[model samples]
Target: MKPIFDEPEQYQSAVAKTAEALISKFGKLADGKAWEAARMPNLTRSERAYCEAVAVRVTRLVRGGSVPA
Candidate 1:
């Protein structure tokens, strides 16, 4: 699929930024699973919906496709 960014440089930068943010927020991707586990119980229905939307956005952004692969 075509990249979401206009150029390779932009794509690399976007990936780097995503990685950096993930690292900052959760130390590493492993922590992401932990975070998800910790967050599940406290989510209200509306909060859960918002989280699902954000997950879909992130998936599309990284996969460079609007629809799920």
Candidate 2:
């Protein structure tokens, strides 16, 4: 388990690997910058759509028994 905000080399490596795998499998995210854009406090319709899509995909993948990392 990683400590919060530790930013260890292993953690960075794992994040990069996971992102690569997800992008490769999903073929470019629909709202790649949604995370940062969502900090506006009032999300737009497209932002909501992007978040929902991401949640659904993640849930389906987890339910499918492919434990990420």
Best-fitting candidate, measured by lDDT? 1
Clashing pairs in 2: none
Candidate 2 lDDT over 11-34, as tens digits, reads 545444544455466543513432
TM value for model 2: 0.35
Quantify all predictions' global Cα lDDT against the true fold: 0.49, 0.47
TM-scores, each model vs. reference: 0.41, 0.35
Full-model lDDT, candidate 2: 0.47
lDDT of 1 by residue, 1-69 (tens): 664444656545554455445545654342344346336988877555444444444444444556432
Could you give me the TM-score of model 1 versus the true structure? 0.41
Alpha-carbon shift of residue 35 in model 2 (angstroms): 12
Candidate 1 deviant stretches above 4 angstroms: 1-39, 67-69
lDDT of 1 at 6: 49
The positional error of residue 54 in candidate 2, measured at the CA in angstroms, is 0.5
